[model samples]
Every structure is written in C-alpha cells, then in structure tokens.
Target: MSKEAIVARIEKKPLSMTINGKKIGPIDVPVGMPMIDFLHHYLNLTGTHFGCGEGVCHACTVVEVKSDGSMVDTRTCIANAHSFDGKTIITIEGQAKTDASGNVTQLTPIQTAFIEKFSFQCGYCTSGFIAGATAFIDRLKREPVKRADLETAIEEALNDHICRCTGYVRYYEAVRDVALATPGCVIGQEDKR
Candidate 1:
C-alpha cells in the first residue's frame, strides 16, 4: 500500500486491557498507533523505553499473556495498539511483586539482579531487560533448562535484547545467577547464584 493510503487508514477506538493487575481503559486511542505511544501518552506508564522506534531493538519489550496463560515478550514499537485489545500486558511496572495486602513488597529477581550486578548504565534498556528476563525465568520454571544446555538456553533467551551501555556481561551474569539460584528450574545446577 502507498504511504498516503496507510496514513489515511489510521483509526481511533476505545482501548481496554489489564495492566499490572488493574483494569485500564475503554479509553479512546488511535487504532494504528504504536503500543509504546499508548503506554507513554495514554496510560502515562513511561517505563517502557523507546529505543530504535523500529522493532530491531527490544527496548520496548512487554510481556503478553497468552490465552493459555503462557507469557512471551513482544516489541511494541512496530505493533498497533488495537491488536492488543483483549490481551493482558505486563510492563516493567507489573514485574514487581505485590504483598497480600495489595502493597508492593519486593522487586522481582530480575530487577534485584540488575541492581546487584550493575547491569544497566543509562537505564533506558533496563525495563525491556526486566521484561525479557522475567519471561526467561518464567519459561525456565515451566520447562526446566538442562544443565548441559544452560549457556545456550540463556543466550537464546536474551539474544533478542540490545543494551547500549554497561557492557553485556553483567546482564548475562545476572540472568545466569538468577537461574542458578532457582531450584528445579536449572537442571543439575550448581550454586553459582
């Protein structure tokens, strides 16, 4: 389609979805608008970063809860907000654990690891990393990683992310540490955590 044709098709509609455990919207938004824009401008949840504005960088990663209750990381920059209407989204803000009394208690393991390992520099990519890491750790919990394939598993999980600063080693180390610390997740694991 021509640029003008695509531009002419930009639409507006009410958006409704579950964000962080809260019900949001039935709010109006442009149909073709990027999910990142809706997140920042409409919802005022700005933690999801805007990096390349293209899908090349995973800085805008958000966890999409599938119908089967499985989760995966998705890029928002290249996706239309309307496509997420019925889906449950977990952004960086949702990654934190909440207490029984509805108060937020502690950060998720990935967030804690990031701080401990000093994995981020400017922190623009930290949100995305958290999302990806959460998904990775969750996946391991569901389908445990074999010890023999531990390194490859971690690499495959995080390879999609792009971090501009603080060197990649720290981020990888943090993930490995978290994985090793979790029991029954990493098969035949040593206590590297």
Candidate 2:
C-alpha cells in the first residue's frame, strides 16, 4: 500500500465511547476512510475481518445503532467513518472484559461459547460470527424464540458471511448454544425435518 496523499487532515475531535466497560476516547481520525480500515489501520483492532469489499460478507460485521433504539450488525468494511461520529460502536476488541487488577480476563460468554462449540477452523470468520451471535442472543433475550425463529435468526445473521472453512454448521451450533443457554430462548418446536 502507498501513503497516497494526505488528502485530508484528521482533527482532534471529541468521540466519547464506553467500550465494554471502560470509557474510550474522544479521539481524532481521518474523515473519509471506511470504519474497518480505520479500526484495523489506525486503532489496530484487527479482529473484525473482511471477505467481500462490497458488503456482501458479514465477515466485517460490527454492532451499530439502527434508526430505532435497537442494535444491528453493520458491515464495517463498507461503512463510512464519519457516520459513527457520535454513536457507540462495538468491535471484537470491545466485547471482552478487562480487570481492575490490570489483567485481561477470559472471553465473554459469547466468545467462550464459540470456542466451546469449535465454531471455526481458519478463524478468519470467527469474529464476525461472534458479533452477529451476540446480537442474535440479545434479540432472543427480549422474547420467547421458537425453533423456526431461532433457525431464521441464525440463517439471517449468518447469510451475509462466506466461510471457506468449517462449513456453517459449527457456526449455527454456536448460535444454538447461546440461544439454548439463554432461558426461554431455546428452539421450542419439534424438528420439522
């Protein structure tokens, strides 16, 4: 890659954020680059993967606020940086916990679930699946999800991602585990198959 040109100078603007539990800054960043590039190149938050630059792959998924109060997985690879100007964005880096005693702790329940289920092989697609699964679990938390609904949610969430390794069955299992672990959210109906 080339430095190209400093077409623009990023200002020291305020960007208040509370990632995980810590309040991250009010930092300055280039205004035009995509959020994924900024996160990887600038912030060094590389866990967010990129498969398709055209936004078809959920490999670059990150949680963001929708027009409504709910949160949805948005493709960071294609999302503009300035669009997140004031909103709180959560990347894979923001999903884990940090100890007050100065030690980084174990992975969150969602992360642990992925590992326990052996959700991925190459690991390229793991983070995005984690992000999407987090949202899916959150959605299930609010209501009683049926078997079909659980499958539907998993299908919709995983549809945008292309995993060349570890066929999607494991990913589905991860989501299923999270859903089943959450009370009242398990696939309740009989297997139609």
Top model number, lDDT: 1
Model 2 stretches with alpha carbons more than 4 Å out: 1-18, 22-25, 65-69, 100-103, 187-193
TM-score of each: 0.88, 0.80
Best by TM-score: 1
Task: List runs of model 1 lying over 4 Å from the truth.
Answer: 1-10, 98-104
Q: lDDT of each prediction vs. the true structure?
A: 0.86, 0.73
The sequence of per-residue lDDT tens digits that candidate 1 reaches over residues 1-193 is 9998986777779989888878988988876889999999988889999999988779999998888887899899999998888789999878888877757799888889989999999889988888888888888989998777777888899888998885578988888888888777788876644
RMSD of 2: 3.8
lDDT of 2 at 143: 60
For candidate 1, the TM-score is: 0.88
lDDT of 2: 0.73
Q: Model 1 clash pairs?
A: 11-31
